[model samples]
Target: MCHIMHIFLNIKFFTLVDFCNAISYEHVKLLSILKLHNVKFFQFFTRFYQYHQGGGFVCVTTARVCSLLQYLFIVLFSTFLVECVDYPVLFNNKNTTADGIPITGKRHIQLMTLIFVLGIDDDNLGNLTWCEVLALLCQKLPDLHVIITKDKLNELDICQRILRFKNYFVALVNKDMLPPVVNIPFLGPQPYLSSGLKLNLDFLFFWGSFSPWEGPYTLKDEYKDPQNIGKLSNSFVCINTQCHKFFIYTINSCIPSVIHFFLLCGAYKKRSNTKLRHFNELDHQLQIRLSRSYDFATRYMNLFTSPLIEIIAKSLKFVTGSIFAVLFALAAWDEDVLTVNLEHALTLMTATFLIVIVCSSMITSDDCVYMPERLMRSIIACIHYAPISWEGKAHTRAVRKEFDSLYPLTFRYILEELFSPLITPFILFFWVRPRMQKFVEFFIRFTVSIEGLGDVCSFAQMDIAKHGDEKCIFILAIDGVAFDKDEDYIANDGKTEISLLNFAAMNPLWEPPPLAAEFINDLKTHVSCLSVFLILFEHILKNVW
Candidate 1:
């Protein structure tokens, strides 16, 4: 018995020593890993601060290179950033002129023109000859002009006075045709595609609508003849001198003002897709689908799995804790129950902070409550896992950074929600209200009144006849009637057509209209051809390799 006990004791001692060594090594390894991460975190933030402050060049360049990626970051990061810093402080940190006028799109375009079009260096942007100014106007200016008869000399005088300030006038006219140059990428020291760009500008000047603003902003009065209020523009030139007043300039420039107002009212749709149930409020087919989706999600889908629900649950807990804390404070302070004292007040304040901020933070941090165990292995994975592609090193890092920024996984999200009520009103009043006119114009111009459907978004109707691309080779003649391919109907980017096809495929029982059937066939043919071309190209490249 003594011999067996001695052997067991020796084995236990060795095992304990080994365990201690393993623990020590793991502890050191963990500290080193954490230290590395801390350094990387500090460097990342320092670089981000420097990058954002380096003028508008970075933002503009990023937007041009990958607009979708830029938008994703803006949506994901801007919200979190908004909580920490004011929007003006975040976006307007760039260097500005001594006059404090932030760089506008108009100014950017002129700068680009000076560099790319005129081949003028940055230092010599202001230096211009009378001939050079005229040349710029003749080449880049929009075709729009105001005709004044001899009797309307006052108008001519006004025009002359406007032209006196040639620099500003040039900027204004350039705005009419070309989009802001900030949208265009920088093309180094040498002017790239200067000839083609100049030719395109010249074409726009001669053929495009000559208006101060685009089609969406055109007024109803602009379309009507000054002499005869009812007479609008029509096809073909008027031979009669009297009919000259009704010359058609551009259809877009002649849209009624009321349409613009309507567009503004309906521009911002709520995030919820299935909120509208009535057919009148939505499309007939859309209404049915929305109803079915809502019903199915409610019945079969786990509501707790929704991120929105998780947020709401956290908010409710915070609210409840806050209410209880307040109630407890009121009850304890009541003269009848206990005498109010400084010590008691201080204790109450501390308890309130603990209940509201600290406890709420703890509750919010527990993100696993809503996420399914099957979907994610643990809370660590749920928090750190970012679905990002590894194509470009820089791009991948940016997307990962943005994804991390989106889910701070702290009390910040809850705090943001708490403060949103105070901030949202100011945003609506100052930002959205000021631009109400533009929004209204967009809605009115894009919407059309159908016979049975009443008023619907023109884009949603999928009317190839009205909005179909003329250059789309897939469009074929059905029966005796030929579909006109001359009109530019590139609205919705074929999303509506794709959605229709998807719906048809999902619901095999559903029958499409004759026109829609024809459109689907053409689209399918186009897609098949594209697929074949891609496959063949891939095969050829593989064989070559």
Candidate 2:
């Protein structure tokens, strides 16, 4: 390096002399002066070039070389140290920026892009959950630019967090291999492909066909080594465009340690199949450590396993405590869900006999009550075990269900369940087969109403059924068809009417009277038992309402 500097310095000296036409002896004297005082050599050379302008061939040859040296220095320094080019703004995420382009399709580039997180079903995840990592990522990155975020990171908070980004992109992987496989049966070709990521970025880096369910982020398996099975790309974070050099990495091959730090903490998903579950339960100790840094892959393999150890411990406690609680409670609890010790065995026997006598007398006393003995048995059993009941510690099944309820219910899971069959059976069936919901809803309401009476939905259904297979009375167009018109029939018994405009097709959007035929047949077949439902319902409503 010093020699290179010297050559350039000498070139400067000769160029001044020759450009000014200095003498050869003058050049020799200047060279000597440069040798004596290296500190002032440049100044001396300049002054000598100005004062002695008759060096002939000596000054001219050296002057040209000096000029060449100056250009060479400019080129080398710019390539190595300074910005090779300037780009004031970053543009690549298409959703946020018009300049955004699909980048992950480029294999070499994808390999060069670091895998921030690999959401496998359940292998290396040590102690933490991907959900918590996602929360942290949002807290840190705060932008919709990455795939796993809740909203666009461009919001003020996210904008501030984004300033911390040393890179242009962050990939968030959603591990679909988690437990409790809940696949929608109806969505055949068009499953509700979960969009794994949500982001607001100028450029998006994606590799696979990226189903709407897959990501705002990219994936690892989506871009394998082509020849190998699970080979990964270690040289990620280098696939940046030349323009990103100005804004992201100050040098090639320099991925900010922040990404790997996140990878270490975020890789602990319970299972990759966590389609709609929140997985953020890290152990107390590791969580404290993780909160300290956003870039921590420097710790090596320990980084991957530290959380795993804690998870194993917590999980052991979870499983054993849960299993034990269920077994103990079930063994201890009696039919009334009352705890019973050996001393209370006689008391339990007496209570059972008295209850049986009372129930038997009630059953035999009334013909209506006796008629629905099986249903009465069901009601009695329900009294023995209830959904919301928590009074007794002896109900093992209840204890088992509440095992993990010690933690606050995850809002994400709640939301997912809301869209599922947890509450509205009709909602689930509606997506695949609407006809099924009509009958199912009618059955529930019918069984529940008992007295052959029900609220609006049930009444609406009964009215529709009574008008069996009838065309909608509301379709009163000029081309309207009247009810009971055999000319425009829809259902099996041929009682319902169809519209003239519709020709022969029935209006599927609006069901034929609620539960047109199947519901009627099922209800009639079970009416002897169903009448008891009415009696029970009337019994309850009369006393309660």
Candidate 3:
């Protein structure tokens, strides 16, 4: 019996030592993790105390507390770094100015011209004659004046003159006298073609004016009058000329104004996708750390049997203690009274049973009433990326569905139950109000940019296309019929076929509906205006009544 008792004592002592060692190790591990993440011990302690006061640590073991602290330290540290750091903006090196402004296609052309002119060698300039110099200057500048007091131009060295010109150019740029950068309109062929082909095609379209339909044609006797032919040809030419002029005017006058309006409205706010992505990534990391902490805390606490059993044991003790106190009171009362009423005794017992059951139900166990960590995480994520209007409610639902689909049905149900109460109020306060303000701001800007030219040009283009196609077909038919020599005029038939094909290729400008490029540009402007206006109108109505 003594030998058995000594062995039992040794085992108990060893078990106690192991438990103490484990607690010490966990404390050290937690401190190390906090330090690794650059979290100060003082801040950690402050937060831990606050968390404890918040009832987060109620009924939780010391090891669980350590795990919770470590998780919080990582999340808080990451959030601090993200909020404090101002990461440098990165710009593409290619086609970008020294100050990191992107050089648009139009600005690029002007820069290239300036470079080419300045790159001329001194020897090459010296060999060029006066006429060549004047021609080169004409190409460089639209307005040129050469005032010379000297009788002979031979006194001026072309190289020195060019160098002087370059110095003047530098001085102007230094003084900020240069024109503001502009994106040149892509007025040539569509960009689908290869660069070399596009360049050649653009050159031909720019310099060549030979129309396939403007070839030699013998009119019928009734239509043979030279004056009548001249009048007929002049009308067609006038119509085409007017159409080209209108197109040019719209692009040159209207597009720039619209662009300027949008700019002024601050519609072109510079937002970095990379920064948003970084924020999202930080949020994800925080979520993972929280999950890990919960797992660690739960595992450590569960090392001792089930928490539910412990809760039940605690509840039974409370009920038994209450019963004993009641019995003692009743015995004392019975000593004071001759006898207790049977009905009163029965009522007292029944009331005590009901009270015990209710109190036990209210005594939530640590396992049963844990923090809604997953639900909290989902809410935080939604708050971060939620759309700011009822217009985007469908989108929010779609996003929720996608995310929810990743989880099992049991988890999904819990998340939905928690999320439902928060969704409406959170979206209204956090998302909608600020977005409405932005909508009003951008709406004013869009209205200013359009300057009442909204869709007028688009409508005109459509009308032109509708009428132009009919006119083209009529003109082609007249040419084919007038030039027909006989029923067997195979040669004339071939020419007419070729002409029709060529016309078809060139007729894209006057095709129904508009070019895809023009349509997209117009659509963007229309949608911007319409969306902003509708949102503002909705906001006003909502506030008024």
Q: What value does the lDDT take at residue 244 in candidate 3? A: 40
lDDT of model 1, residue 488 = 27
Candidate 2 lDDT: 0.28
Can you list the residue pairs that collide in candidate 3? none
The stretch of ten residues in a row with the least summed lDDT in candidate 1 is 4-13
Model 2: residues >4 Å from true position, as ranges? 1-208, 212-394, 397-509, 512-545
In order of TM-score, best first, we have 1, 2, 3
lDDT of 1 at 151: 21
TM-score of 2: 0.15
Per-residue lDDT of model 2, residues 1-545, tens digit only = 12111111211333332222222334434544444232232233233322133232344445666766765665566574456322333332333323435536432311111112222112233343433333443343322122221333212122112111111111011211111123446722212211111111122122223211122221233232243322212211222222332232222112212222223223332212211111121123223323332121111111122345445545554554454455446556654333433445445445544544433322212222212223322322211111233323322434323322221123333333233323222222233122322222222222212111111111112233233343333321112223444421122221122111111111112223233333333333444454678799999999998
lDDT, candidate 1, 1-545, per-residue tens? 11111111211111222222113334424433444232232232223222223222334344455655654555556565666445554556764433334545532321122112223332443364323433443332122111212222121122222221221212222222112121114622211111122222222222234321232212233322244322222111112111321222112222212222323223212111211211111122333343333322222123123356556656766776675566567767674333343335545555656656543433334423332222222211212221223122322334333332322222333333333334333333343334434333433444454332223344444454554443332344444335544432343223334334544443344456677677667656655676699799999999999
Best by TM-score: 1
Higher-lDDT candidate among 1 and 3?
A: 1
Q: Could you give candidate 3's per-residue lDDT for residues 1-545 as a string of tens digits?
A: 12211111221111222222123334434433444121121123223223222333232344455666765665566685687444442323344223335546532211111112223332354465434443453343211112122222221122112222222222222222221122326623211111122222222212123211111111123222334444443442344233442343333334333333333323212211111111112222223423433333333222233457657756775876587467657757784322343435544556666666655544544554433333323332322222223122322444333333222233233333333233322322333233333322221221111111110111111121221232223322322222222322121112222222222222323222223234323334544675699799999999999
Among all candidates shown, the one with the greatest lDDT: 1
